[model samples]
Target: MEQIFGGGIIWTIFIGFIAGLLARALKPGNDKLSFLWTIVLGVGGALLAWFVGSTLGWYKPGEPAGFIASVVGAIVLLAIYAAMRKKK
Candidate 1:
């Protein structure tokens, strides 16, 4: 059981990293995020997508967001992050 839980975390991290990379590549801009930040962005994006999708009935409860949706969510987060950073 421990192994399963641990593996799930590792897998989530891997997916998050991939989603972040893809979002960065697809979105046009100079995003200077570190490796860890990228992963966080991806994971955050996934969560955002999940929330939005759930609210819109696009995703059922407990269902994970799709990769494309995750990437899109990451891009949205990146845009927002950039905007906030620009305000500083």
Candidate 2:
């Protein structure tokens, strides 16, 4: 778990929160996410980026995703979330 997270759980949560804020700021449009949800989004994005990067050999084992990549991943997730919400 520590290897996957690239740090201890607390560190991951801190990074995730920061990434989430950046992602929300960079993405255009309104996102009705609470504080907790933002953290979840960021963490999820980081995981997503790590998985994709690993598959593409951009990241070796136990390597954490870059900040930019994390933000990008969050943006992609946010877009998907928005699209899904729009459909409802």
Candidate 3:
């Protein structure tokens, strides 16, 4: 954790929170999502963030790219969720 402690965890959490919120907002019938679902969106987005950062070189040896990548991933997921919902 110390490796990231220099500066990243907090931003990651914040981005996760925002990403979940955006996901919820973009989700069709998002009102039906429970609190647990929101947490999932945030955490899942955070996980995706790592991949995005590494793939795009946003993730330096020790940087705070997780937050932005997570947010972007969450937004993409939310858009997908919205599209799927639209099909229904």
Number of clashing residue pairs in every model? 0, 0, 0
Task: Provide the lowest-lDDT 10-residue window in model 1.
Answer: 1-10
Give lDDT tens digits, candidate 1, residues 1-88.
1121123777878888999999999999999899999999888888888878889998876677877888999999999998999999
Cα lDDT tens digits, model 2, 1-88, are 4553578998888888888999999999989799999999998889889889999999998888887888889899999999999999
Q: How far does residue 26 in candidate 3 sit from its true spot (Å)?
A: 7.2
Candidate 3: C-alpha lDDT: 0.61
What CA RMSD would you report for each candidate? Answer: 3.7, 1.2, 4.1
In candidate 3, what are the lDDT values of residues 17-85, reduced to their tens digit?
Answer: 676887667655644556656656766776666656767886776554455556567667677777888
Ranking by lDDT: 2, 1, 3
Give per-model TM-scores. 0.89, 0.93, 0.59
Query: lDDT values of the candidates?
Result: 0.83, 0.88, 0.61
Task: Give candidate 1's root-mean-square deviation (CA, Å).
Answer: 3.7
| Top TM-score hit | 2
Candidates sorted on TM-score, descending: 2, 1, 3
Deviation from truth (RMSD, Å), model 2: 1.2
